[model samples]
Target chain A: MIATETALALQAPQLMTTPPLLTMTGVSRRYGDVVALQDVSAMVYPGEVLGIVGESGSGKSTLLRMMNLEDTPDTGDYRLALPDLPGNLFDLDRFARRMLCATRIGIVYQNPHVGLLMQHTSSGNVAERLLIAGERSFAALRGRAREALDASEFPLERMDARPIELSGGMQQRVQLAKAIALEPVLLLLDEPTTGLDVSVQALVLDTLKRLQRDRAITMVIVSHDLGVIRTMADRVMVMRRGRVVEQGLADQIFQDPQHDYTQQLVHAKL
Target chain B: MTLASLTKPWEAMSYGFLDASAKRELRRKMLKAIAVPGCQMPYASREVPMARGWGTGGLQVTLTLLKPSSVVKVIDQGADDSVNAASIRSFLSKVSGATETWDTTEATILQSRHRIPEERLRADQVLVLQVPNPEPLRPVEPNMSVARQMHADADYGRLWLILYEQIVRSGRVMQGAAYPSLVNGRHVMTPSPIPRWDVPKLHMAQHLTFLSAGREKRLYAVPPFTRVEPLVFSDVPYQVEDHAALTCHRSGVSGYFMNEIPQDDGSSAFEVSDSHLGIKTIRQAEGAAIRIGPTWYENGKMPQ
Candidate 1:
């Protein structure tokens, strides 16, 4: 229902320069009696970071999952504007979806355990996506892994160490390295640093910001932490009870929140 | 009680060493497995005369389908006369009154362990491969229930991850035998411990292949014309062993899979892994009118 956000802050002039990467309209999802999301519409433009900030159970994670095709919407139009793929993602088969997800988009989960194979080495984790993407030569995989790990500020010495041997910060860095290793057009992140110590959170965020700039990747991040959203997002969407309450550019939303929930979130964080 | 009454009444043994009910069960499972290619169907792998791991699975399938008119061939690692192969061949013949044959062309029902015959199986032939471990997901997920669920979901990401890791660590997918493959493009199946060289023989081939793990109580099939594709990145093509260029020391036959025999001084000797093929080649060279069936690999390569 057009509850808020009449004009997206991306600006029409800038929109003319590049087409949107993902667009969803009237997307809804339910789990039995629980309506996780309802009539949520959003668009992700190229090379920009869009953040969905809401408290837990506000359907932010659900929206993020739908973007990654982890869950399909019950009723709505969800399309991915990838050059190689047709406009409507739902029209493609699972194999096409898998290929698109593996090669064109990368995702980092909240838990390092979910994002990584525990038995594999840290660099091996980064090399995993490339391997899946059909990079055959071990030398090429190793070289790319080294470069990505270095870009994520991971130490070269511990490249071969298992995930359990590294700290939470390092594990997140490995995840980031893997997510960016394929140089994907889009990256989806779900609470990438929530479990890390507050002091260590900035390190992962900094690495993410640097990777985003270097790769020019359009990113969608969902989190309950306003600080994370403020530090990373170019545009922000404030959601409440499965609907978008307010959305605009990062400075506009933070400096002058239109919705009461957005105002509350901004004030509590400040 | 009378001595004859006290002694148990002599009941005749069932044909093929299995009762009709057990054979019926296996036949049902086989039909289902063929209907849904590559999907492992659970079955009651009845106890057989042999040990649990040593070709018991193949023996059960052989016994199930065995008949007086059937010609059975048993191969242990491609050696027709291996002790295990010889024992199983004789046991099958002893129970079913079937003719035992070492010639791949003559085999109506061939049961093999570790290696598939180099001779291409015909449409009328059935290959029952003995499986020690049935679950291809065993390396990734240890829990069988979870593994079954993973298969149901087509969640083969973890399997691909293992192949990915192998490349990262060892510079290649070091999975030598029981290479995991996608059957009919849906189910990922382990084609038993047959070498990577032989996996292609199952892909869209004329013969039907049944891989059974009696110890694991599971069986799966690759019906004729079913796709059996090994898991490899599109850029990284599947590679068989580098035995094509090597010639057999005994038969002087080249362009087939070979066994490496290490010497005391470090030089190795190469022998054709298929002993029957080697014997046939040697006999043909001696002009004894030996007939060799068409091979899967021609000139050391599967005709692409």
Candidate 2:
């Protein structure tokens, strides 16, 4: 597990000592004529869960997907300075680009259903990444996968259990285990806890927190739930119409009134 | 049904494209592999422009199995890059003009090396594993007759012995990759060299998982709904590894397996354990453009 706080503190002279793992500058994305994000700029700093919040059509998902490599921007540049590495992510080729995406970054969709293939078992979901990474040695795959399952607090019996057999929370835990097992540097969570019940959400959040502190992974969580953000995020980026309306520390965003849109968002939640 | 009827001619002799004989052999072996889950067979490996050991198994399957319109993904060590992966991708684009993708969901045929894709492979996806060695009995006994006999009788007695020893000494499974498993709770098989982390992902996968060993003469499969159990002991139980520190600075993911590339400073640089191509999806995300600030960086080199 990477120690998120420590990784957040590492100083790279080339990066100008920015804590950000990914920095977007004047980023704009258009799908033919549809502008998804316009001049959106933000830095996803280390140990900080930048909560991209907004209602539907706010471009929150689009913005999050952009950081994932599934979607490419039409204009502007995205620099991903790996926490400890010298080179940025953009320096890779199409093949190299995809390899990094699967192993280095972990993404959780708003719908847990989207994140996992329902046909596979809980263990299968957790172990998929390991297999893809070319650890074809069966002993190695099973041992590490089982370890991840234990770390995620999943039941041993569920290793062979299919996704459909598990509860929503259990499936989420399996997804978390899958992501964690890969040891990704960035975690892109699209409404990670949205569909989950309160108790299950708490469990999942707690697991993420433990994993984060242990691993030191940088996180960019996109959710409308402020509470989830408050609990996990160090900083927040509030998205409105594919633009950042407000950005600051989590505590400050909750207490201080910087932007009316942010204030209203906080108020409505409260 | 006749050979002449099935042996069709090609208008364009595309490189890396399997001829009729190769395709039939591959298809026949694939069916055999599927019938006998977790078995490995040697297919006629093609000389792709890419070097060997990248994704020969995947590329072979792709060339033989692909339709004209099939959308394929060639991932080496789980990522789509790496010299071998890129070459395979290039080869497919030339011969079949098939669409290639890094995303697991979009791919119809996925040729993967050690690691599986991070995303869940669906029923629509057919995963072809590149096997260095296909024989599950290779590690145990050298005699083909004995190994085949053992397999026929579902004899995994040696597996238990191996697990028991681990318990006695390490008190845990110290193994990392290429873990062996029982397909359908009967046939002892290898899940290829993919990390243990990916082993569980194969448990009843929606897609058909095919294993092809080019160097070795073997092919195998784990049919949908077929049980693939990792070899483990009941007393010590099975343990999976977690990134005590799960984080990738570039991708901002915690709780994923990472490869530690040790720098000169003695500090380890964290890369995703899977090949780098898998991370391309994240790097190419909508907001990712904000990171580089208008520089088009491709394949680790800046366009001049």
Candidate 3:
């Protein structure tokens, strides 16, 4: 038994060295005359957290939106490497994009209120994702919702409470629970902890870290706060004026930023 | 814009009283509303001849779905002869060139306020219910934005609490009308002021139901065979009003909802609430050979 356990543990790190799960090349999105994102290229590996940092209107949201398939890029190639199907998601039609959004991608908005359906019970909110994924049995839906909420450490008794009744922190946690309920291959978060209190921010970050590690889920997190990026990101990308300025390992980017904008960002955060 | 681009050769009126663009928009919204049963889909509420609060929502939906061959029945609190019901019915037929009906059995489309017809709706029929208030959480959370957020979160704990409080205070569920019900086990929709007896008819029913609120600019649907469970604890089952055993004085019809009339001598006389049903029963009794259809409630009891 000791030999088998040792072998399994040795194989785990080898799995981390696998090929990238998603890769984008020269992705550009424009709204009429204004460019939202231009020539933004990046890669995300399996079970890794990629943090994107930029000021407001830096096109960080536009890049994330493209990655989420909520908006299509005007020009670029986005290849998502799945186990069975590794194809360009941008090439798919609107209905296909919607299907992918339901089955493969899960997103949590910056505003918890936007992420959640305030009228539904917490379990109902989670159950909706499952229902969209074609789960029909009530028992199965409820069971999965309960499991996800439990994993997120949400109060089991208040699972039926609406978002309006819960605190801002609890609403964010419910959003997390709802997003992870589907067990998607990719999870996207936009300004997840911006409006949260300091103590509640720490708790939410802690919960997110645990979920990422335990589930081995790949993630793309967009935030302006460097502290959030430093704590949670495996890699970091800096953006300015709708363009990628610099990209590197989290420690390298924090310590030795190449671009002046990135250096100024690092200094400002300090 | 040029006159040619802005205007067309005018006719007497648009078919179904609504313009083509209005009908198209409603059609799109109705499809989405049907797709996600019980989730309120927002739409642009168009102008109709009737006042805003007076069944305009139902009228808009009925107009959108109306055809020349369609037979429509409008009911106000189970009575077809009421002023509101009669006017709406006449207006619908006059505009669409369709037939107006008082028989639930013959109606291709049934529009109602505060009631569902006693007769069981069939698979082919569509029922449009006028909703004064679309939000079920309005009582608990007054803020519309917060209520919307709660709806998005699927949080309905306060609703259950309200019911629990009602039971504790009144010894029974005192909510007499518009009991909040969970639709398709997901959304807690206000079944549009429907009596408790009528709410159960929506659960796993053969026909489709659309509940629209014009003032609120929202609409929802309960498609055929969807589950519509009334909010209730396991220990306390839902109880409809006790009107099953009372017999109607004029038509001698028993085992249905009734309206009570008080006598000057301090006595009470009951009449069938569904006026058309009462008329049909009376006619059948007088040997006119009218066919009374199968009802949702059988022999004063709704089957479990």
Candidate 4:
């Protein structure tokens, strides 16, 4: 068994007693005439990676955006059942939503250019998020940024260099560092390894898995690649168009997919 | 719309010489500049009565922050009596109804050209330095977009190469005024043509500083307690101009920066570069009770 499984096994009784970290019911969104998501209901338990896989126009990005609060759904009931938070997260005011987005939620975009500030130093990009979250001391900010970059396996010397100087793979690592610097409760990643080389993708995936295992962070990873889902996810949700086609354990989804679209996807991969 | 609704009041001039919307925009940009020390924040450089290059950038900033109770000070190359300085100072007071002072200690806002005040400014003061050229990479890369990309990439290798070439040709760095310095250890900025001697005064200064360029439409800040280090190689130490030994001929003050006056015969007479400091020294010598505040340089050397 993997380290995450071993850790989960150790905390099995406590995990059973705790509530799901996040719950969404009947979430629907539309942009003009086109529907992005339709009547999607999902629950993400604590300390687990929930992978969403779909084709190009399959509402997966839209779903991740709704979760990150970048885009609001037309109708939904979203609840964050953490111990410290009270009431439904979807009912938060504009200011409260901003606060939660800034402090509690971290997101990694598919394009590193979108995720990281191109003009800012790697350390500066990481420190920007911490500064928004009210970390004032320059020493403390730099310290935490350095720690995060180290965890992401970025070179310590290049922390002062800007994003333009870094390669595509390095920029992605910097983005990961910036996202996780706050040690947020929830992480949302959309097509993180899509544009990266195979070797670089492997390295990024390894660093991400190590970080997730170390922090036990609840995550929603959206990807079109079934291989990525199989490697990273404990539970897989297969999406097509604007609906969930199949949802189950990673092994079951890979070995015995019941839905036609999922079976086609598995066969194509094989 | 009715004529009465079109015009509210027959006021002579707007408060602080800028419209309310302009002030609001500048205020927002100023906050962003302070939040990211040394990062240049772009803004709409508003129109003023003065020409674009003649302290218009500083004028806009002063106008944005101006109030009736503010004490404004304007100086050109350390002299308050210069035509540019006097005109800007009068214009500021006339527009905002604020008090004008030559004393650095009494001023709440000090807008200057080419030189910082000789006296140490308090924490309450805001220094606005007029900049002709804001980009330090202009010497290395002529294209603005490429320069911006270089800035984004933190690729300053060419800037160091320029300095290295200067050292190779002249046996020392040839940069005189507006020496490029690294702000907050991230962004390199040209400190607005202030002499090398004046550059050290900005390091970890108590007062907030804004460097604005009107034509460039860019403004950056150096917040209080931020680092401003001159770029220099360890092998060759950074050196200020050798004006420490020169004595001011009129004020009889030694160790301060001085302006060299060529005499008819073949001799040079030195006068204090900061005219206000010289005036105060002359007053004190004439037995007038003049209170001179603490200076950045004490007896020709900055305090360690």
Q: Which stretch of 10 consecutive residues in model 4 chain A shows the poorest summed lDDT?
A: A1-10
Best by TM-score: 1
What value does the TM-score of chain B take for model 4?
0.96
Per-residue alpha-carbon lDDT of model 4 for A94-132, expressed as tens digits? 656766876888889998877876765778778767765
Task: For each candidate, report what fraction of the true interface contacts it reproduces.
Answer: 0.15, 0.00, 0.00, 0.00
Q: Write the per-residue lDDT of candidate 2 for residues B221-242, one digit (tens) a residue.
A: 8888778778764434444556
- Write candidate 1's Cα lDDT for A85-190 as tens digits: 7566756666667777777778888988988978778887887777667675656777899998898899989998899888999988888888888888889999
CA deviation > 4 Å runs, candidate 2: A1-270, B1-16, B41-54, B274-304
lDDT of 1: 0.87
lDDT, model 2, position B210: 85
What's the TM for model 3? 0.64
- Write the number of the candidate with greater TM-score, choosing between 2 and 4: 4
Error of 3 at B45 (Å): 11
User: What's the candidate order when arranged by decreasing DockQ?
Assistant: 1, 3, 4, 2
Q: Is candidate 1 or candidate 2 better by TM-score?
A: 1
User: Candidate 3 at B278: error in angstroms?
Assistant: 3.7
Off by over 4 Å in 4: A1-17, B1-49, B56-74, B81-83, B86-273, B286-304
- Provide the lDDT at B249 for model 3: 99
Cα error of candidate 3 at position B34, Å: 15
